[model samples]
Target: MQKLFSLTLFLFTFSLSQAQNKFGNPEVDPVQIQKTYEQWSVYQNKNIMLSRDFTALDVSSKEITKEVFLDQLANGSFIPIRLKSDASVYYYKLFKIQPKTDTSIKATINQIGFDAYKNYKMEGTVFPKFSFKDLDGNLVTNESMKGKIIVIKCWYIHCTPCIKEFPQVNKLVEEYKDRKDIIFISLAEDSPEELKTFLARKPLSYAVIPDMKEYMNEALQLNSFPTHFILNKKGLISKVLPNFESLEVALAKESKF
Candidate 1:
């Protein structure tokens, strides 16, 4: 079975040779390859600590095949991305009859979460202080944010989940659009021009701030995409929403404060 699986994989990689490299040794057991993929899935959802350097050592731990695959996937050398309406999916383009497509194969490679940092346990802590000029050059500061319920969302133009969640975020902005006590701010890693182009096609009413990746990394220690922070009236961090699904629940908790 292992020899047959290896032969199958070789034939598949041969077809995509122009696009990707062989991810594993031909002699490598198919069972081990499958295990490597499974380990990557587990790391993405749970054990991944993005605050540290993201490397093969960080991703696969002791598994050699997993490490090689993780490196190739990160560098876009082996996998091809498929964008779907519901979620962005990845497939082993070079590996034939592999686990992602075959249930019997048991090897799975899903969308990796390099920036899926969930270390924001600072709910009761004071929100980190900073100021930046919005896209319109309006100076936004923690001082200005004080005495108001500040909604801060961290996103980038290339983030699929971030883009998908924009409509709901916009609705949340509209619900409180009439109120001066509530402020909506988005901190993006994109430049002002990139944001301008994206927002032209898909408008977001929030006060969009650009070039905030450094602030996110240094101040917030965020290693993930689409993180939302809610600062209460006192400017203390009230709730931190990690993904789009947490928006409503985070808002519910914020409503009481």
Candidate 2:
């Protein structure tokens, strides 16, 4: 059995007006969301008002309702948005809707949900050119990144696994800086000065781009933290690795193309 309830939309800023939409969270962006939605009057609305898609990356094949899960995203910070269903689930069984093209948020959800709801390996065509400021605060370019296998780890100072990977990633950068074949990056949303004392002592050999979360996130299709997108010699996104090392080895191997 499934239930469809009204959705309470929330938006989180990810970039300047120019930043890319990496999270696939189109509704979360005020610039691209509805200031108002038709609120539900009762759990049982004998009349359907509108239809929208709900999405999440699932390991569990259970069917939770829309109202049930939206409340969780609002109150239970411990749980990310989840769908208790799978690809086999019917669309109308989830909610009633007009054509997906009816609205902006609707369109974004459809575009993003198509990927978020499935088990996907990151191997596809994407923006190839990449650039960001290195630790010194000087503007860095993709040209400087030539001849290297770039591992752009889209992260922030607060991400745990990001900090955890620093030592090993630094080691890889140290070993390969001269080779022109490999690179490691820890891009953050904070100012370089905020990390100056930290980076001064560590002195990363590869690169560090601070306050670039929005542009880079969009530039790289970033959704998961410590989202590792590997770029090969051709400067294309050759792989998409998520979370910690526990989930990255195969991705690391595959994206090294």
Lowest summed lDDT across 10 adjacent residues in model 1 is found at 81-90
lDDT (C-alpha, whole model) for all candidates:
0.61, 0.47
Please provide, for model 1 over 20-94, each residue's C-alpha lDDT reduced to its tens digit, 9 standing for 90 to 100: 322322223333444554543443334322222222221212223333444444443232211112212112222
Whole-model alpha-carbon lDDT for candidate 2: 0.47
Tens-digit per-residue lDDT, 1-257, candidate 2? 12222221112232322232222222222222233332221211222111223332211323466444333323332123212234433222122223322354344344333333221333445434556667766765678876666677677766777777777666665545565466666677678787676667655444678887677556555666676666676666565555435224533454345
Model 1: number of clashes? 3
Error of 2 at 108 (Å): 23
The true-structure Cα RMSD of candidate 2 reads 16.5
Q: Clash pairs of candidate 2?
A: 20-218, 62-84, 63-84, 149-181
